[model samples]
Target: MAKEQTAEKGITSRAEDFAAWYNDVVLKAELADYSPVRGCMVIRPRGYRIWELMQRALDDLFKETGHENAYFPLFIPQSFLAREAEHVEGFSPQLAVVTHGGGKELEEPLVVRPTSETIIYAMLSKWIQSYRDLPVLLNQWANVVRWEMRTRLFLRTTEFLWQEGHTAHATAEEAEAEARTILGVYRRFMEEWMAMPVLTGQKTDAEKFAGAVRTYSCEALMQDNRALQAGTSHFLGQNFARAFGVQFQTAQGDMDYVWSTSWGVSTRLIGGLVMTHGDDVGLVCPPRLAPLQVVVVPIWKSDTDSGSVLEAARRVEDALRAGGIRVNVDDRESMTPGAKYYYWELRGVPVRLEVGPRDVAQGQVVLARRTGGKVPVPVASVLESVKAALEEIQAELLRAARERREANSLRHVNRDQLTEYMEAGGGFAYGGFCGSPECEVEIKERTKATIRVLPDPEFRSDPPPASCAWCGKKAVTEAVWARAY
Candidate 1:
């Protein structure tokens, strides 16, 4: 027992040290590690596996919506980025430029893509010649570089992998519809698959993407009571098409520029998952995204009973695997069963099965849930039990997260109240806004919170009741403000 305690001793208590607990889990869980380069991280196999599951689920959703995958160059020409004024101005501060190559200085510097809108739209200009090519739905899975002053692993790294979907439509309405549709996909992915609750809405004009007419996002409340913009969809509204000269001939003997949209979800979401569901012990991955949903461990007191325990564990593993569950059996002889428990728990496997000599003798297995605690299950019904338990754990996590969100959220009219709440670690604060950049700036300066999103038009059955939170004038919209990651 003393030896076992030593192996698990280093993880910091969550309440005592939240930041250290997070870093410990990220490193001890074998998910990610600090890289030699500052502001960069190396995602290990366990972390990459979670990302792979996410990619597979999201790819299916994209394909279902008439989107196709494609690749773009890693570097975008300086001239291409300059084509869009707002985009260039917004991204200039974070741009990583390559001034030299092949031991010589280049005439025009190339930028590592902070985002792919510029480069992709430039190609769309050439591919779209006629109205027949009106709607080009393409997405790319790639890595982008953004020079951040401070970084945190998957949450704010200098370089991270993501998928960006860029689409061209014949009309503004179609483009806007596509943006909302993708936003729905993101909401569903976060709520149903990842078991994370999110608030879906539009960004304020001041907070919208640089070149977008409107931007939609799904924001999730972290355990720390701060909001994370999990994903965003932007309605370009001909901005990029006009900049890139992506015009197509119309059927009525005329020509018009295409309307475009771009949306993305990045590795930052992995961080959201950690902060939202993880506890003091380690990560508590949702069943749908857990790379190994169940792990079977065989416990034995002596070498004489090892063969029987191993056989029984393998049988249980095969049963789970046959049920379409990702299962692994840990049969390493050198490590004790207690050590194996700590190892898999740190890795965030959602469920674990213990098949010891006693359990095998009784024709049963002991089940342990990573999200909570232990449950004893019979071998005959082990498959069904595991399945039901996984579903329950997933639902419970979402429900718990939703409750935390509700508890932390605040709706206020007074500016003093807003500032006080934010200073005390606020969640989502909803208030009336005048839709002025100055008002937005004032709020940001007073309280380190920005306008996260505005309530959807369809949800606004009631009008704004009072003046703007920052300015004393008739409010135009109700917006959510929060300290964001």
Candidate 2:
């Protein structure tokens, strides 16, 4: 049957062709697919479930940090986006405009938001009246639209799901602190849950968000050695407040523009996860982020003994589920045990338990980890073993990713050496930048490398480079430069 071959067909090898491998894995794994709409994608149930887990985890963090969830209009008045000059110019080219409404020409065209900073600030102005309302923390989980000429499934789609956090504060210091705080949260989430190591630092002026006074990000290196900006937190200072008339009366009877910040992480994170830990076999999800932490596939010598094995598998599943594990029992009669193993492995289930007639008789089950290890545990200890294996797998994934990042990363001292190395194949290259836009532009033009992040001393693993890598000028700071996604 055609269904049987779905698991038989293998994905493209990541080493031979990484991009093709990514697309093949995404389609073969049923995570996502192209849509009729240009540059858009349909997130299948498999993919959407991963996103749901991401949403729940992030929402908990946002709430614990005093941010409340809210909704805003999907359509923004064209004039509203034009309120901030830099913001408007930055997003204008990507804006999808709507002119007709209700079978009639609208009086004013609307822009499907590229980002919600402009429109959200418009509402904030009315909500905050005095210093008592200075810090207004809000977050929204929503889909946003941006017209794109080129697109990839979860990486660069025209329409994508994301959570945008917007906050308003009374002073520059408070706003800056809020941005950094969220940046730290993003770093923690990416490292702990996703098990992807990241370099947290500031973006160069050329790389910062439009109209932001400063932008900080957690830049992660993919398995292919390219950089992915997994998350960003931007400090808007007084720009959005001034443009949108968001001001609160001070306790001293004076009115001043509110300081603002905005930060977001999108489905692009799904892409990062795929690239960061995936291999030639398929996706290898960390236990913490995996939708199905454990899958029990019952094996049997014959259909005569299948019921017994299935029963054992069910008992194992029930025990894991009771212990707070997301477990699935593969009891399909149509598939072989090998097919089931291939199916769950391709889908990146973290731990797989195989309960066969012999194992059931012996009161043991074979434990196979997605991270490439196997063991046998007594049936009585299945729950405890699964718990321990999941924890061990989670830690190992983070450690392995960190080791790979360090291995692929390179250190360079000058432009020539960096360009030569990048021309061959690009990775994270630590070096010094002169902090000149010209120098940055030249490197991008020649080697296609951008400053991924300017690392803080504590985050930098090596001694600082003495001079600019792109220009032989005095170095402003040590930077991790790479060709990015």
Candidate 3:
């Protein structure tokens, strides 16, 4: 009986097998399922709801920052990609070409977009003619295909849903500002709503987005102490504009190319949330972004007790709903109270309320928190308690993640020290870099760790080390290195 319950309700120990545990939690919680397609997965209703919440929050942020949502074609002409030399070479391996459509071969081949820069820029070139159209701030929530050889559920897949923001500006400074602004938006969204801690900085040239003059990214440390690139914002700096001849008449009446930028965060964030906050039991979703905030579970001894207990549960649920809480009453007759607790816990519902005949008689109910611990609250005070509990849980999760990141992060003065740290169960290593692509490549080959970020002041110190941590050459910047997902 114990073994069966463990098998049915528990996942593989995270310490023993983190990958197996994550796959089990994702499947058993009904968040998603493997699809018939070789490297695709179906987002079940439960998983989609979480994504919907994320979309609503992020969309509102984008709109508030003066970005309007729009749509673009999913297919692009092969010639457009060719116009941008580095962009085409960067995406060549992942390009999925469509040579035939409508049951006939076409004269020109179309490529499913890995990213929309080429096509979007072509349209921008047609739409802009003067300084009046200086900045075109647009975003699109759509699906993209990259033809990935290896895939994970939400982290890396052949096809996935995401939002990409592309903007055109009159000056390089304005374009750089737009990219950083979006980076701030992404950092706040990930840290505040998702309750995840991240390091924000510039990516090294070798690791930056292809065709971008500079790329900025947010890197989050997971429970397993590996890094995840949560989101990125790229400063295109007239590269795409020049490729597509997006020349705009300036205020001074001169014809010059416009500066451009693109930034995006995808469904992979869902996977980051899981790995950052989840445990051996299952996912541990932060309250502000959880699909369902509160679940009401009723406990009854007999049919007689069921009548009163369920009535009380409904009253509690109605009260919670009236208090502006997302609530659901689990009244399944076939499942026991323990079973319901396990079910809701596995799904990472922030709070669970259990009402029984005794609680109803006493005018109180039992509250269990997914983060851990239980308390009892009177009917009159349940709302306040629930709200307080959720806020506390959200803050606690962020605090815990921050502490874990700090604890695991290390500062090394040389390559030998970096190697020792990597061999001893790596976290993030902060060191000085010479800013040479060849040096980064050699380091990756030796340690399997690449520069994750050239961290901000908060994560980096003043006056970088005197020489490169790896080569003892002139140090250009401080960088955080890690083995990533």
Candidate 4:
């Protein structure tokens, strides 16, 4: 992370106001800033580096799953969007259409990409002519415009960056498997790399993607006890394939429309990272994803000692770098060592090594873990000690977040309890849903809460509830409800 930015003197305590506190952390840490255009943000160097790390991890996962990387056009012909009725209807409200180009009105308007599904399918139809081309696994990283009315910097924005994966398969089973597999990949990354635990499940009919047969997601709870839909994978059973004529010959030599799937995770995750682990002081970035994992701060009392301390600091930095850690040495003349600690903590550097005249003389330095701890380690052993501390911090964050989510959650909640909890306090509530959109809508209307997911086996209530949580009717299935971001 960049080391020169100054953090604001005060942060709104999360208890004072979580929304305000979030904004304070993002701006004060120099993660992002407001741009000239409304509803847009300029990702600063530190923020972009975090996003870059996230992109690389996800890209590698996609490739390992046998998916290819490709690019699609940003502008789609207006007629292309209408090829799929449900898709067009769902996106119509947010579409940004371009009617004039080169200072003259084009014969037909073009739509800025809200997603690449429609355009990708149109090209797939042209490319696939036989059974051998049964599975076209591809993903593209690109920017999308959704024209959000009210936007939050990384959570919701008018235009944002993301990776969208599109694949075509000969059978519905293959497509369904692909969708589920992607969701698993997302879950693994969230827990292993980001150190954020998540629940996986299928979204209700009312909440599934525009033209999807089914949609699955990874939902994570923020520190404030609100749910965040972190990522989604959709199974499209010949919906887009039929609309765009993406057909292939079968082994029997018959032509049939192909089943398809699409999934994606985006920049919104950066916001989730902040909420998941950040403290009142500043961001507490997960070590695996942090751009600068270790920041070495050199201390001194006099000019004579300053030179030796800085030399020790540089040597420590080189050793850590050689050990494959992202490290930075701060030896600026103006800022005191104490100021450097505050600055790095705000930026979420996972570990800090403090070197001083005394420590250098003793051939040791004070090794500090950002999560909270300090120990003295001999100069010769700095690399190994720092690596172990980083791993411990990563595991500790995930463990703490999982415990918090469980502590605040409830099961078998009734209508009265649901209403009271949502109004007075908020957390995940598991109960039965009647499998009716009308019933779900009524609950939302009254409580401003929605079903997060019909959770997977590990998260479901043991011996599920017998009646609907809201209507008191016979239960159809269990669902997790929460006020979400």
Comparing 2 and 3 on lDDT, the stronger one: 3
Q: Once superposed on the true structure, which residue ranges of model 1 sit more than 4 Å away at CA?
A: 1-8, 457-465
lDDT of 3 by residue, 1-485 (tens): 12222365588778877777778778877888999998889999888888999999999999999999999999999899899888988999998899999999988999998999999999999999997997899999999999898999998989999999999999999999999999999999999999999999999888899889999999999888789999999999999999999999988889999999999999999999988899877888899888899999999999999999999999889998999899999999999999888888889899999999899999999999998899889988899999999999999999999999989988855889888777777889998998888889998999888899999877786555777889989888898998899
User: Of models 1 and 2, which has the larger TM-score?
Assistant: 2
Kindly list the per-residue Cα lDDT of model 2 for residues 1-485, writing each as its tens digit: 12212124787787777888888778877889989988999998888888888898899999989999999999999999888888888889999999999999989999998889988999998999999987999999999999888998899999999999999999999999999999888988999899999999999988899989999999999988889999999999999999989989999999999998999999999999888888767888888888889999888888778889888899898899999999989888889889888888888899999988889989999999998888889999899999999999999999999999888788854778788767867778888888889988989999998899998667674667778887778888888888998
Ranked candidates, highest TM-score first: 4, 3, 2, 1
Q: Give the clash count for each candidate.
A: 0, 0, 0, 0
lDDT of 3 at 191: 93
Q: Cα deviation of 36 in candidate 4 (Å)?
A: 0.7
Give the clashing pairs for model 2: none
Q: Where does candidate 1 have its weakest 10-residue lDDT segment?
A: 1-10
TM-score of each: 0.95, 0.97, 0.97, 0.98
Q: Please give the lDDT score for candidate 2.
A: 0.89
Question: What's the C-alpha lDDT at position 355 in model 4?
Answer: 94
| Model 3 lDDT at residue 34 | 92
lDDT of 1: 0.88
Error of 2 at 212 (Å): 0.6
